[model samples]
Target chain A: MLKAIWDNIKGLYSLLVGLSITGRYLVSPRKTIHYPRQVVDDEILASFRGPLELTRGRKEPGQTRCISCQMCVRACPGHCLTVIKGDAKAPSRWIYDFSLCCLCGACVEACPAGALAFSHKVYLVATSREELKLDLLADLKARTEKEAPPKNE
Target chain B: MDLSLAIFVQIIVAVLLIIGLMVGNAVVMVYMERKVAGFIQRRPGPYEVGPWGTLQAVCDSMKLLAKQVFLPGNVDFILYYLAPILAFLPVLLLFLPVPFGPILTPLHINEGIVLILAFAGLGVLSNLLAGWSSNNKYSLLGAGRAVAQTVAYEIPMILALLAVVLQSGSMDLAKIVGQQGQYPWQWNIALQPLAFFIYLVSLVGETNRAPFDLPEAESELTAGFHTEYSGMGFALFFLSEYANMLLVSFVCASFFLGGYKGPFLDGIWWTFIKAYLIMFFIVWIRWTFPRVRFDQLLNINWKWLLPLGLLNLWLTAVLVKFLV
Candidate 1:
């Protein structure tokens, strides 16, 4: 009975102490990020795994450095990547099914030419299932077009 | 017709109370957890949105609501669909028996204590159904662990509670509270402190809280039984969890801490304060302790708490018979 009483007293004491600490923190400022609307910027975003991105080499133009070796296709554990080898003249057609892509970056590293790079633009990827299937040729074309320097005078 | 109208009104009031308490506490607790986690980890948390991220829960809810509700192809249609609701319903119903304040007992069944335990135990069923129906091995494992933990902890919890019931000599929680009022140190905690300690520990474990949170162990189970859930399904599970936490705290306050028995102010305010204080401790424990191993969790209850609770009950009975 004495031991029971003692335990209960200690329990009550501990409960009160715990509550006091929590109560103090409750009144204190909160530490949650209101995601989407009041977006957390790059500094905090670095820690979270939101989405994947693709980056290009500074000096390489029209050169993704992806040597159509199909290593990324084989290495891609998710099987989200579809690569159609382009003629030696044409850029290799690499289709990325974002739906299947695990964002593991296996494909990015597998590119021997350093052509395939992860981008930082982690927006809502796609809505429709069909849209998530990215045409490699079209993506490359767009990237080349976007990266191409404005026509010189 | 008049009786039916009264019943309807009572139900509406009860529902409103449950929703109001659950939503309000969830919002506050979510904010509190983030801030507390941040404070413990030596960093500023959520300083940007709506004055220190007060609206963070709102934003998170909106984002989740907007997100696509994915239904995995391999999942069992009915059970998979029903899992979240099953997981959530017990938490909602568990509040029906909880006495929030002195005069503000919303839905008081005669056997409130038993009702609370029964509903609380149902939380495991939902977890199991979710894991099994999802057909995911990890989810199944999580659910299995949850069931085992629930079974292990609930025995000690009930035994501890039985000690309080033995002292009070009634199962009706309101009467138990009334009985406590007759004594000088009214709270059962003063009389049966060991039982109270056992109750607290078992309550935490029963609720799958930290140091005992094996079911949803993030590192191991990867979000546990609700791994396959998305959108509203996930939201329901989230809502139910906070509701469970609140329910546990309410019961703890009622059984041991002298329900609604404060020094000066004697009513609903005291009850709410005590209950919230209990909740704060629950959250504090969550942040403070690392999760206990599965084996350790069972052993703690069976080896230590069960025997101690039984002994405490025996001692309480003898004391009441002789001293009281």
Candidate 2:
């Protein structure tokens, strides 16, 4: 009975400790990252993996790193990657179904040509399921076209 | 001030002011509760409505008011309608006895503690009606739980108040407030710590707040007794809940924390600061603790609170008799 009373007193002491902790937090600077008004720094977002896109050859301008290899297409467990091998060395049309993509990085790891990489630059926001079916080759061509800079001139 | 007509006009004005304050308190508390909850969870709460979401409560009130008054099939029309009004009305009466500032008390009467306790008890009837009239099993269970919880917690609350009452040798709440000194050491809380402890527990349980919110257990009861109520019906119950928080804080401030009494500048502002501090702690505790089980809730009141209250009362009586 004496021990029980002692334990009860200890409980009261602990309760005060809890109160003190909350009091500290009440005055401490708020840890909230208020979205829309303030965005997270890209330095902190560097490690964030979003969706898969074909990587362009760093050395060779206007050329992709893909050699029309079907390693990624065969290895994708989610069957999200579709590579239509065009006439030799021509820019192939790649259709990526983001709806089925599990984001497991299996396709990226299986790529022998080092053609695929993840980028969070364009965070996917689509209104419809059909919109999630991204025409990657067309997007790659557009990007290359934009980067190619005034061929007609 | 002695003129009868003047007294009547004063009473009317006081009533209108209290009514207006009641609604205004609900809006402020709704906003504050969300902001506090958000801060505790490490997120910004309700920042879009008006600068830092200050007008979020106003927008929410408008939304609730604008919604349809939907009544589910086979509900008792009269009882269903009366429940929210009944829950709200008696609380207004509970505000009367306590002194706000020195000259700021709207209504003053002797036997103030008894009047407040009696009206506070009437809240249970509204819970019963709300539960029964809804024609839902879950609502009935929630009402039953609420009724049981309130009935149990009220004993300790009264005992705590009674302990303070014995120390003061008066039932008048204003007189009780008058007895305490402006300094921290001279307050009734310093005199009777155990009683204050009991009052804090009972206040939380009696108010049906978290850690004891079995009745309104969202996961189990699906909004509990207010499940069937929509539009203004839900709004009234919600308003009362916040108003009840203010009322309980007022009681705590008056009875224990020295109402309207402070160092240097002594006025209504001290009372408000003290009351809001108590409220801030309550909100903090709610976020910190999880809800207790129904059986655990009852066990807490019956096994722990009641006996401890009785012991505290006995000790207070003995101390007051011999020492005072």
Candidate 3:
């Protein structure tokens, strides 16, 4: 009978302890970041693996680092990467159907030329299948044109 | 005595005001419960709709109102219709006997305790009817559990109340409140802590709320007695549940914390604050603890609450007779 009474007191004590713990948290700073209203910088957001993007050449800004050896196409498990063969100096047509790209980063790892990197575009929602078919060569050209503006002689 | 039209109008106005407060209470309690639960878990809860989601409850009622009333074919038609009405209707009368302020409360009766308890008892019948008429196995089981839980918990709750009644030496709620002073030291809670504790525990069980919320255990029973009710039926049950919450809080305030007596203002605001503090405690405890098992729930009421309540009552009786 004494033991039972002791156990009951212990049970009530534990309930108070639980209440105190939750009570402490009730006054604690709110952890909610207010998702839509406040967003973390895309620099931090971009670090997240959104999709694959060709790394810009260090020597020629906005130009791709790809050497056109077809290493990425061969390495891609999803067979999502399609690279048109070109000379080392010339830009190659790289069609990346993001629809099938599994984001394994195998191509990024396998590229001996260090030509691939994860895209900073995190919001990559696409409605149509065609929208997922990304033309990487056109993207590279647009970047190079924007960065390396022709000298307006 | 001749019936006066002025008195009749006053009663009508009071009744209408009380009904309006039920709607108002639902919105406030729903908002408060969600926000309290959220903060306890370190989340912001609802922050949209209006400033700090103040209008979230308003939006919820609109949504509930928009929903099609889905009554299952298997349900007993008469009982199903009646259950929702009975669930909420008694709560209207329950508020009449409460001492909200020195001059407030819709009706004043000598046997206020009797009126409150009798009406409060009707809630169980509604719960049973809701579960039984639904014709679902889970609903039937929920009703059975609710009946058992209510029956078990009510004895201790009454005994605890009896202790207070004896201490105050009156059943009139206003007189009971008058006995306790303005300060915390003079409160019934200070005087009858054990009874207060018993009442709090029994309050949780009596209301069919969390830890003791076996009847509506969402994980197991899938909305319990009101499982089949949708739209207006669901809304009425929801409203009644919240109105009951306010009712219990008011009783807790009046009985233990000294109703309407405060430092500067000796009026209804004190009652509101004390009542809400109790409500907040109930809300806090709900989020803090998991639902107790059926056996454990009954055991707490029987083995602990009942014995403690009886002891407290007998002790109070002795103290009052000899000392006071």
Candidate DockQ scores, in order: 0.08, 0.40, 0.78
The lDDT, on a scale of 0 to 1, for candidate 2 is: 0.85
Instruction: Report the Cα lDDT for residue B152, model 1.
Output: 89
Query: Over the stretch A4-97, how does candidate 2's per-residue lDDT look in tens digits?
Result: 7688668768778776776666656777776667777899778888777778776654566777688888989999888878788534788889
The digit string of per-residue lDDT tens for model 1 on B86-123 reads 87776767777666666667666788888888878778
lDDT of 1 at A71: 85
Worst 10 residues of 2 chain B by lDDT: B36-45
Which is superior by DockQ, 2 or 3? 3
Stretch of 10 with least lDDT, candidate 1 chain B: B175-184
lDDT of candidates 1 onward, in order:
0.77, 0.85, 0.89
Worst 10 residues of 3 chain B by lDDT: B1-10
Error in Å for residue A28 of model 3: 2.5
Give me the candidate number with maximum TM-score: 2
Better candidate by TM-score, 1 or 2 = 2
Model 2, residue B72: what's the lDDT? Answer: 92
Ranking by lDDT: 3, 2, 1
Colliding residue pairs in candidate 2 = none
